[model samples]
Target: MPNPLDPSLATLIERHTGPVKQLRPTEHGRGSDLTALAETEAGAVFVKAMRDRGRAGGRRDSLLREIAVAPHLGGLAPALLWGEADSGWVVGGWEAAEGRPVDLRPGSTDLPAVVDVVRRVGELPLPEVAEDWPEQRWDRFVAPGEEDLFAGRALLYTDWHPHNFLLGPAGCWLVDWSWPTRGAAFISPALLVVELVAAGHQPAAAQGLLADCPAWSGAPAAAVDAFAAAHALMCRSAADRRPQQPWLAAVADAAECWAAHRAEG
Candidate 1:
């Protein structure tokens, strides 16, 4: 049977002018439903058509929300060219974000750069998101539910995986914005640290950089924990939803560690 949840590509083209050429399938953890290419003469665009879980009401709303906020977050990440709410399509002409995907494997070259980027990202002004995931409520979603923990808020891109970014000509650019939320106390950096540790490096190695992070430098440890949990949850959820994804196993494992570590502390 045809998948009832599959996105309708025709619906996207119908909204735009000129013929749309469907480009190569972009690789992502949740199966390749994202379409890329410019219109006959309308500049390059990346269309994130809602499919499967993304079609669920909340996910659809988040995609639309990202479209609205992209213009403000553009310089900090990838620039968004055009987008439509109902169609789940956002066009972005690609830009460069330094370094390759974060490889936790021992002696990986990208680790240092990843650490730097993490700190920088924290410092950037929270993007122009129409809705901000509340600071208090954000903990429930990103935190591990521990007591005596408090977290400050920052705009966070849930998926900061290396592959989601590129080190192209205009400097580093983070492409996907399907998942973003207001800062949870510690969930954002905490989760990233867990990913680094799970990848085989000592969390202490990056601790200095993380501690000195200008973006969230003064954020409480609990906040870090919350961000970590949220990030891990995202990876784990993606793995559960898209088993065939090559990165799921490792990413999920890393995310799980983030969750586990916070649970312990």
Candidate 2:
């Protein structure tokens, strides 16, 4: 029942989430701490072990951020049960999403559902971002004017891949809120498009999904191209940082393809 990775956390959860049933390793995003799937008396929750180094002053209360934003986007994501900023173990109820990692592959029915979720996410109101939170840059490889399209005080999950979105009982529920960022406008959707392309979705399909986005109607194509380029650079940087990360490399390749396609038009 207790996770060998963090025995102390198992003990803590017994007190917080009731009896523990099982613990298993789960998918995790880079630039964060170790994570796992944990089941307890309360329900299933994601466990993220925080690292001491890196930015945000050691995790910077991610669970707190999720707690703040979850209520607002409750239907869009799972419910947060409890967490500790110092320990970096945030727990939330798990929902069964219809899609899986490979579901992002071509011809996967999950594509339409993913597109729908991305559209819905675009419509969700931005959560209030703390002024002290680290600011996300928009002008990375993209032009400067493209930056303001997504800037706001809203809380954003930043990571918007089909992997992060689970097709649960209610609908698609987003997971891994560890990298909460301010401003929910262009960043998440931009990430989603890049992810869709990376997951083997056709270029036209991915673009159509983005084009259909109501918020992006008046958005500059150059901005999406810039974001796509920037996302590629970021992925490559991440791959470089984690040389063994195959997923990052695949995503980088996809980003390149999307960038080239955008260049043609």
Model 1 TM: 0.67
- lDDT (Cα, tens digit) per residue for candidate 1, span 142-253: 4254522533456766566667656544555566666666644344566566556666755555344466665546666565665566656666777889988867877778
Q: Give the TM-score of each candidate.
A: 0.67, 0.76
**Cα lDDT for residue 2, model 2?**
50
Lowest-sum lDDT 10-residue window in model 2: 90-99
lDDT of each: 0.55, 0.62
lDDT of 2 by residue, 135-212 (tens): 455546556666564556545557766567677546566666655666635566666767778777767677677677
**What would you estimate as the lDDT of candidate 2?**
0.62
Each prediction's total of clashing residue pairs, residues at least 3 apart in sequence or on different chains, is 29, 4
How many Å off is the CA of 151 in candidate 1?
A: 5.0
